[model samples]
Target chain A: MRFPLFLSALFLLLLPLTAGAQTKSINQFYRKYKHSEEVFNITVPGWLIKLGAGIAKSQAETPEERAAFQMVKKFKKLKFMVMEDHNLVTPRDYNRLISGVQSESFEELLSVRSDGARINFYIRDKQETIKNMLILVHEADSFIMVSAKTKLKLEEIADLVNQALDGDLDNEEIVPVIKPQA
Target chain B: MKTFKILLALLFVAVGFTAQAQDDAISKYFNKYLDDDRFTVVYISPKMFQLFDKMDLNLDDEEAEAIMSVVKDMRSLRILVSEETPKQFFDEAKKAFNTNSYEVLMTVRDKGGDNVEFFIKDDGGTVINELLLLVGGEDEFVLMSFVGNIDLNNISKLTEAFEGDGDDANDD
Candidate 1:
């Protein structure tokens, strides 16, 4: 009787941990695809974001530049992965990656279908505020996923995009994802 | 007793699976793309809007505060423009949206374009869940969606700041 009771208790204890493990995490995708030549991974640490913000701050002499950097300062940890090789990262692979990335906790923020690319944006919210934002850009030739750890507002990003278009930001490395509309 | 415990564990897993079955329809289009390179896409999340609330817009203190307050409700914004987008694609997009039962907020016929339709998914008449703007033109098309508790009045105010009396709109 005691053996059965103890076994049941152990199962109960392990259940939560196993449930947590099953949830798809971004780290898992990074680990799985990092080895493949098709996947190009870029991890920007908090320090790098801070450094980028600092450089942007120094470059801001004009009002437009200052306005643009204001948005850049909020970015913390950013991870970007792009599937470059079409043969390896086919539509099936893209769908699989998307399914793995989409979790119950993250809410759908935006999804757009453009000429060459289809972009999906998701966010994890805490206390009515966004804790993290995930962006999936699937193009004809490639699939790109950008995970940004931030509390910055959504419209501020649009403002930043608008500001970026104003010809203030010269730092290409930090702002690789912002594709201007023609 | 061991068997009973295993059965309970399996039940828990089944429940978890059932809970995650709800999928948003918009996600389906997030992987579709046309071969032509005549499309433009823009996505902005609510977090960025929250960041905007924190910024000093260099306007009058009252005006800035009011704008920020209106902006707080916006969650996300997505814009897609395509020059080579086909009519069938636009029709299919509209049909998908219709299936989701999004209510039309307004429709306008522009001299330059065929028609512009604005659709809104309202939440309890207090907040808007999603707002969709689809502009079908003769040559080009524009599709924009804003997800959140959006106030249309405030949106018009925000547009005025950028468009600035529509003086340069015709320059394009």
Candidate 2:
């Protein structure tokens, strides 16, 4: 009877810790999934794309400014790229992602790595808001993408993405709104 | 014998006229190349003469003699030039060279590859065209242009564009 009570107390104490470690549910909209080698993919949703576009337009003051703003309007942008062990993830790894995303136009952004040997990526969408952040693992047959933005809309999710990827939301150069061509 | 002396004096006058004509052509060359943006100038070594086309120079006696012979033998060529710029390569050349103004004599078009302008100094006489804008001073030349077609730009990686390990500049 005493042992069972102890076990129940321990389970109750650990539950909140586990919940705190995992991302919030609305984080599905700006997914941050990790691969074992420290390389991971992160994404933002379609709705936030429009909102970012509006903000970019409001900030511009001149023809050059407007031209710069127009240049980056395309698919979903890669948020941040980090690598584990500070090693670069090879181009071969991107094949798995490009095949799955099914977006026709894509461009690679920065590739960074963390102290723990994890790699990161910031890829932009050419045709679609990223549905997934594909994480490539060492296993030959296994791969996965964590849902970045859980279920949040633009206003709610933009903050979350900025916080999650350590992204520079204010940096129009880094995270431009990807819009369809008129 | 008196007639011979008169003939000799006339011949001397004719020689002076010929020299003056060459100088006029040189002045013309300078005007055509200067103040034009479509063309850029580069300073090259004599060793690079074989590497580029349509080079211009106010050659010394030996070089001019050799070139004259070569051109005469070739029959279809006058002189080989890569490209050229104004002779007043510096801002002060207009005043320093005693040429208050410039008059054009010859113009060499880009032939559709490298946009270069050629000019010669009127003061020096137009026996040759000097790349004016590329020269730091009267006799010195340097490469200061970063043209669009050269694959170099004002991007963040300035130093790498000149020489870097990963630099992708084509070296012939």
Candidate 3:
């Protein structure tokens, strides 16, 4: 009788601790859809990210290259998923997925609708700084979601994008996989 | 020994506070919408810039050297853009600047939907530590923060380096 009471007490003691460590909503979503036929999921932890940044940093010689390499150091993990094939996933279904995604703790940072495609950016912040960010894009035939956990400040990322749009990467066409907006 | 331990604990607490204090207003905004899809986010780290510096662009000596000088000193650059009404964002940005917290470097109303504004964080001297670039209009909203060792004279030269490209930009 005493042993049974002790066991119950131990279980009660650990309950709140486990509850406090709730799994992120995005991670839960990934687990739910990971085995689905149309979903392609990729998860990379910090070690590989640091290794890649190190290799690129070794080759860095210009100001831009060095800046980019430095920024990569903040990333802790990269998670990506693409659910494609229109026959497999309809636009309405994609919208539902997006709604489900928004229902999580992530707050919308930006939303773009162009050419019948919608892209949304969301982030989870703590103490006025972002710890993780998610990007969701829905095209006619596919949906793409990318999540990054990093310590980088928002302005740093913005500067890099500005530089890119300034046409340094213009020689190569980096078009979206989605069809052009109608 | 107990006193020393307490002092060490205090030091750690202070360090933690300092780290948290470093998050600026723009960084807070960046964190707020970091994952939002409507925004195109770009980040260029110092290491990436260094990598580019190593490349052999094969330009003539003067041009190559000028480009190198500009690229070598930049610490970090980041830009965020969104295709939406940014009046609210603009107001927030202005508030974050804390009214006269930074020196107004320049402002220009460019043709079309482009209006460019520049602000600088200077420590009571010619040396500028940070440059804030804000562009706003109907088509897009942009915020660019560049932090590094900046020389105003060098910035003028940097503009000259891109003079040839200006025509190309205008054509677009």
Off by over 4 Å in 2: A1-33, A37-40, A76-80, A88-182, B1-172
lDDT of 3 by residue, A1-182 (tens): 99999999999999755533333566666777778877888998988999999889889886567678878977888888897774244555555655655555455555555445667776655444457677878777777878888776656665554454444445346644768899
Which 10-residue window of candidate 2 chain A scores lowest in summed lDDT? A110-119
Best by TM-score: 1
Docking class of 2: incorrect
lDDT of 2 by residue, A49-134 (tens): 55786689679885444543443343243343344444343335444444433232222221222222222232222122332233
Worst 10 residues of 3 chain B by lDDT: B54-63
- TM-score (chain A only) for the predictions, listed in order: 0.62, 0.29, 0.64
lDDT of 1 by residue, B66-124 (tens): 56656677776666677675455566667777744478789888787577788777755
**Candidate number that wins on TM-score, 2 or 3:** 3
**Candidate 1 DockQ, CA atoms:** 0.23
State the lDDT of candidate 2 residue by residue for B48-126, as single tens digits: 2221112232233333334333322221111211123333343333333334323333334344422233333334532
Residue A137's C-alpha lDDT in candidate 2? 28
Alpha-carbon runs more than 4 Å astray in model 3: A1-83, A86-182, B1-23, B53-65, B99-101, B110-114, B123-127, B164-172
Off by over 4 Å in 1: A1-24, A37-87, A107-109, A120-136, A142-182, B1-70, B75-113, B118-132, B152-172
Candidate 1 lands at a TM-score of 0.49
Ranking by lDDT: 3, 1, 2
Give the TM-score (vs. native) of candidate 2: 0.20
